[model samples]
Target: MSTALPSAVLGAAAHQARITLVRKYTSAAGVSTVVVSLAVLVLLWFVRDVQLGAAQVGAGGYIFSGFLAFGVIAAAVLGVAGELQAEREDGTLLRAKAVPHGMTGHLVAKLLAAPVDALVPVLPALVGAALLLPDSMPQDVASWVLLVLVFGLGVLTMLPWGAVLGSVFRTMIGLAWAMMSMYALAALSGVFYPVGGWPAPLQWVAQLSPLYWIGVAVRSVLLPEGAAAAEIGGEFRLELALVVLLAWAVAGLFIAPVLLRRMARRQSGSAVQAARERVLAKGY
Candidate 1:
């Protein structure tokens, strides 16, 4: 009995170690921070010539808000996808499964660390935008606070889908495809314009994208009242943004875990070996 107890304790410790390892590995990539910086530079350059016509710098604020929200979501998804795919290909995933709590710990760590990793990138951009874009700054502290809360929740909601995709497609190419799709969806969802401005059919499609609601919620707070902000049909639809973001969060929470578990179960010997070779070849 004494021996058995020691063995169990050691097993538990090992499991915890695996989880910690996964979290550390994932956090080291820092992709979101890189992306956010790139985005800020792009935004500054793109809008350099276009002066807002009585819209206040608030228009710039609106645009940055959308970019911030999108950046969070993109970071979470890309982070998970890249980390998991790399692990899957390198046989680290298989090694993880050998430990009693390895997979569970790793997954929990990934979920926990994702938001933190995303925020590292977003916070700086927010500070810079607020300082430099005087006209587009939030009207007051309350609006800024609300925007942060809503956008943070939005990113949390989207993370599970990213995890699912990472687990399901264990290849760099597959991850790239997922990212491309995410960008395309963002475009359709009105990250750049009001979703209502799209053609009726396109509007219907845009509504399905989380970007639409996120943009709406952001615009509602930042744009001045009666600003003729782009509209969908005969109605202004900012009210739907919060609801949609919350809905996506709830849905992703339920769906992502199940999908990840299924992918875990499907991991095979050949796939694992192939993945290992790929990772080693790339020097990851």
Candidate 2:
């Protein structure tokens, strides 16, 4: 039966235009976009290193990977959600509804494009942090390559869930709450520090969110062998990390399409107009 192959193919074909648009957008983003973000990530890494001078870069390797995880989560959760919400309110989704296989195209392009969005800040930040670390970072090309691959996997692992949130919570208020919940999980997820320091209860709670596993996976690749002592149960838990991330990826793979389809089916010009009016009445 011809279920998604044709639609997915058409979507892939249509996405070239969207890719060009995203490229144009990145070009327009220019210096300030990168300069500002790199500065902040670098500064954070610097401060974190200074604060934890006991370890090299205060375990800069772990922190660096954690920072990478944070960027992925932020981009997927905040960036993707905000963009989707804006598209919905501004009738972008409605326009997609009018086009043949447009939604598929959009989703495919997103799977292709959203990581670039996540990486815009992430790549620079990672490089900057590594530069600041005078100690031996992941020096081997394989390790570096693995780090990149891990981040890409991280993006797929989380972006769909982000889209689901964007679809479910169309309002800024709802999205804000969802984001707050994410942050809460991250606060205890050992993204900035070690999980060995967290309370048992909080540690368990953090484990439930994807952020913790993401940090674990990234840290596994970037940090040295002994770094596992700083991790929960004094282990990298790479297997668990992969299982969890893969689980999320699978879940999102299935769930996002259904949610997006439902959202699309519900879209109408009147609904978009109402969203616009609501935003206007709510003020800028």
Question: What TM-score does each of the candidates earn?
Answer: 0.77, 0.87
Top lDDT model: 2
In order, what is each prediction's RMSD in angstroms? 5.7, 2.8
Error of 1 at 75 (Å): 1.2
Q: Which stretches of model 2 miss by more than 4 angstroms?
A: 7-32, 41-59, 134-136
Residues 54-109, candidate 1: write the lDDT tens digits.
Answer: 54334455567677767777667777777788777666667767767566666666
Whole-model lDDT values for every prediction: 0.68, 0.75
Residue 241 displacement (Å), model 2: 0.7
Q: What would the per-residue lDDT of candidate 2 be over residues 141-173, giving only the tens digit for each residue?
A: 897787787788888888888889989987887
How many residue pairs clash in model 2?
0
lDDT of 2: 0.75
Supply candidate 1's per-residue lDDT for 256.
82
